[model samples]
Target: MASSRRRPPVEAPIAALRDALARIDANGPVLVAFSGGLDSTVLLHAAADVLGAGEAGSEVESRRSLLAIHVDHGLQAPSADWARHCVGQSDTLGVDCRVVRLEGAPQRGESVESWAREARYAAFAGIAEEVGAAALLTAHHADDQIETFLLRLVRGAGLDGLVSIEPDTMRGGLRVLRPFLGLPRSALERWARSRGLAWIEDPSNRDERLLRNAVRRQLVPVLDRVLPALRQRLPQTLAALREERDRLRELDRRRLETVTEPSRSAPGRAAALSLCAWRRLPAASRAGVLRQWLALHGARMPSRARLAEMLRQLDAPAADGLEIRHDGFVLRRYRGQAMLLPAAERSCEGAASGFCLPLRWVGERRVEVPELAGVLTIERIGQVERVEPVGPVKPVGSPGRPGLAERWLQAPDLELRARSGGERLRMHPGGPHRSLKKLYQERGVPSWARRALPVLWAHGRPVWAAGIGCDADCIVSKGVRYALDWQPLRRSRPASAPERSQH
Candidate 1:
């Protein structure tokens, strides 16, 4: 018997969404960042369907809590109506809805699209916190990923930036999940239509004045027509890039550890690396290492031109004492070491005029010298309390740090002051006293770093310098000595402060 048989329509979108939810298996309430757009509409519907439909037809026993949130950017005239539509949809689905209205417009020089996106995410995070949502779902699909990839590619992004979208990530303390990253917009439209779901059509999406809109309106259609298989193959390419990114991250960590050391002066929280070791790495791998190194020190990624210029200067063997300033931090190379220090907060004129103040030390363990942009740590070690030396004052070696005798500081005439020119330091026991300027040069200290290296003066003479060791005459061969070390304090660059352009 030849019976008329019809194939069931393919419902790939809902099946994919169900599979994603099953894999995620969130423990608590899931909140959807619903925009009333087609993609989000479909996602919200599927979430409510999968979660609202309990296992074994026991809705009361197996159903999970679901919520929907709408952010009204208030950019367009009909934004309020869209928000109402979103609320109505949520009500029909039996899901709780929250509407957040953004109050202000975009800042001057900021793109409207960028402003809207930032505001929307901020709203999502706030509402998620308010509602105690365990996860926040967004409807960023394969098309969005492709656009992001192309945009970043044209903007000179590296391997790390090429892989644009992820299945999930933590943003502003919210677990932001994108269940539709693998699904195309066509599939979402089909699903929405099949379920007779109504959605809002955002007119701004077709406006090509914005970069993303232009790409979607013009560039994407061309790509779709020219390369029909791109969407299918692009994910594979992105996957490869992601794998490389992960591999390079691990390699960079190991390499950074090998070539870097903590700043000798700032023991707890500063970074210093051997410039010689960094130079020895393969030319191709150097940029990745530099990016990772800078990132660890709280720096934003440098532009390609800036990063290239940095590499050029760093690779030059004769480039002594170079400083590359970026994003509230200064990267300085001195004495074969690269140090990342916080950018000085003082203005150039202010620093030049006011940095020479004489600071009195009253035997405090820690002395914060704002003028010098660092803190002085005076640590008293050893148990002996005697004023006299236990043994003859020995020659100060290259490695040892000479300590100041505690007895000498009993009355403590210690004063911290900037170099006044013509100051001399006898670093070794029998070594000739050299000018502080000559000493700094001989030690390969950069000029910019020298201005902040405070000298410890006692009784109108130079007794200790921050980077330079203790003067030979003041060295204590014995008893209860104070070890003097200075660490550069980390100060943030003021929002109004201008970053020195990297040429």
Candidate 2:
């Protein structure tokens, strides 16, 4: 008979950690997602041992390098106190602790549970990325796993929903780690009690009004009477389903690499791929591939049903062309070609045909494809995009030039505006990657003229001159029946301290 495989040791916090570290292709500097709770307190303590105090501790002391992030979900009455408690714990632990505050009421009618958790997690993620840490450690233990599985079932979630909260997941390059995933909350609580540790007790936890609370206090125990091993079985069940899902997704990806072809040279090739190539996949894979394709280009993913229904229309006729749009996936068939557009570019549509979005916020907009500039409106013959690059900018300011047009353009849309500090560009011909100030001297564009000229950033680099000149190389001739054109503008910058860099 085959021998049974053993579960992970699941104890000794660093033991789980070392194995996780080995699995990654690169060794990530680890950071603990420390909350002042019992679970995370122990997690932080465990992590302190893995990385040395001086080398990994994120403190003002000589023992520095480790980072701890605590998010203040301002939902409870003692939210501030909770944050202070977290900070105090970090100081005691000899790690750098930063408390992030999230404002606004929780999603109404949802008991503030969903919103608070979402906000806290977001703030935690931000701090993790801010530090040079590549991995984030959380203290989600066995009880939480059972709760999660139950919650998913209660909410009518699919098989994927019952899966264990991912112990290691990559979020914007930061891999999330949960050392306590395999351990029970009771174990950690007992350990902390033995160590004589004190923890914050939010009163809401005991209130049975919340479903999670009710589950914690009632349902689980009641079920324990009938099914003793149900809790143990849930996590394993979730793991199996998750493994199956992962394999299927990989198979779909591999199948696509063989069947798909890129034809950028053909007119409307992108559109052609959307209409025909997207339909060739197996019904199960078609929707997934279409969603994947759009997401690759910065578009959002659509619902499975929405994508399937869209392809279902394909049997109608070649002339019937299909346009399916949902969840930011824009599907349009033109000249027997289908195209997917990024939802972030809705404003560009007005410019593409000549229209303007009523401003919700005051800022310049640049369209990189067919190069467009501020208040982009359709123009006769060709569009006009502006470019204005400033000199010496702050990190968050204009990057020395206007936020140029987006980089993913198909031969059009270009514009620029002024921003502050450390802006670098090869503004003048034959110039090294020099500052914008140097470009003005070589071109004699004049100091006063520099602030007035808007920058034309194209493909993350400036490649156009607004008003007086255009990038001599990028212009498409008007003679072509269908040609991409750029209209650029140059303008001065406003003042503001960049509080936080874009995440």
Candidate 3:
């Protein structure tokens, strides 16, 4: 009879992980995302062995702190027990453990899988921040990469999507390190069994309804039987794809540099480019530039169909001022230039119409208007005793009167509102009144943004419009001039104000 003995420990997986970690060279502390699964268990064990727990006579040189973080998604019945199991296992290994309990369920129309992943990563980011760890490790192995590539291929993803699962990348200000990407799942299982490590088996993993499980159970087995060399070939294919992607990205970067213009109103946001300049590129290069620009602004790349539609719209005669909405942002073309703005800023879209907020601008220097999403500043200019009319001295309300400063101070409390319709402004004192619509059209303001642009009204009369400047009726004498500054708030809390544009 054959001997009933256990197989010897496999050191290849552990060795590979050590080499990957060394190459990563994390300068600060490390946090492992311990899910109490076989792959993660092996990862946690290898990490603890390589990064000692500051004990004496350890083989590891660095004494950096090591911690395990388990996120309880609370989707499974045994999830709580799994968390406890992870904590216990980490304790047994002399590593600190943290269990983050997620609150709330996935919203309507949200995929449970995507929600779980987003929540899990959010928890990891928070823990990494709390612990001041520089690196966050996960146990995504070769199998996961293969499954992802296969899934993306089936979904008809582009080159970047095919190579999405990177070995190391930055996420939420922490270095997200996947050290086991080169190691296979079988290697991890062997290592775990050799060390007598305990782990939980998620029953949901066996459900073929999930695409990953379906691939793992049905497709991978068939692929293994039919083409045994596929596993080796897939990685090589991905490496070549990555090289090609890098070349295309470098070319796109150079092209973007030539056509990009700094946003005059929003700093650190997506830059603007002339439609003429964008159209000058080859069709393929145009798509690449668009992808790179969206990536720079942290926006998701649009689908190929949507991208083609955008390109088609760019060619239309009316497309010069059209707004194309997609993926939480609005792509607008204004004055032959294309730029992106947040979708929420589309105050005129659907049921959420533009709002009007009252502002009592007496002697205050600054006023914050949430509805318009920006601040207004009134800086008092130095007083002048008497002033002579300069060349082409624009008239205020009266021909012999002062400029904007004196008139603005005499105005009553202002009503801040976005454009509704039928608004008009005087281009000059005693000039013919023109519709705000016509004025905006002539000035090349995108139609979508006109609704969100701030318009200050005193009592019932329009006094100032952002980007258009103070009303000619409200212009004060040359003496004591005050500049009315309108600063638009950024998507994030900006470090500095964006550059202002004066009409």
- lDDT for each of the candidates? 0.72, 0.52, 0.72
lDDT tens string, model 2, 173-225?
Answer: 35666767877778787767765777877788799988889998898888778
Question: What 10-residue stretch in candidate 2 is worst by lDDT?
Answer: 494-503
TM agreement with the true structure for every prediction:
0.62, 0.61, 0.74
Clashing pairs in 3: 402-476, 402-477, 402-478, 403-475, 403-476, 403-477, 404-476, 407-476
What is the per-residue lDDT of model 3 for residues 122-241, given as tens digits with 9 covering 90 to 100? 787777777778778899998898899999999999887887577766663567778888878998898788778889999999999988999999999898899998888888887788
lDDT of 1 by residue, 1-503 (tens): 87689867546766666655665554777888899999999888878767763224422323568888898887789989999999999988788889998889877866777678767777776776666777777899999998999999999777767878777665545677777888888888888887788999988788888898999889999999999999999989977877777788779878888778755433344568777788778888888888878867757677788899888888778655576887667666666677777776223313643344455555688887776678888886654333343333332232244578665455346567777677898765676788878877755665666666777777768887767767777766665677777776665321112111110
Best by TM-score: 3
* Runs with alpha carbons beyond 4 Å of true place in candidate 3: 1-10, 23-27, 54-58, 94-96, 101-110, 126-132, 172-174, 262-269, 348-369, 375-443, 455-465, 468-503
Clashing pairs in 1: none
Of models 2 and 3, which has the larger lDDT?
3
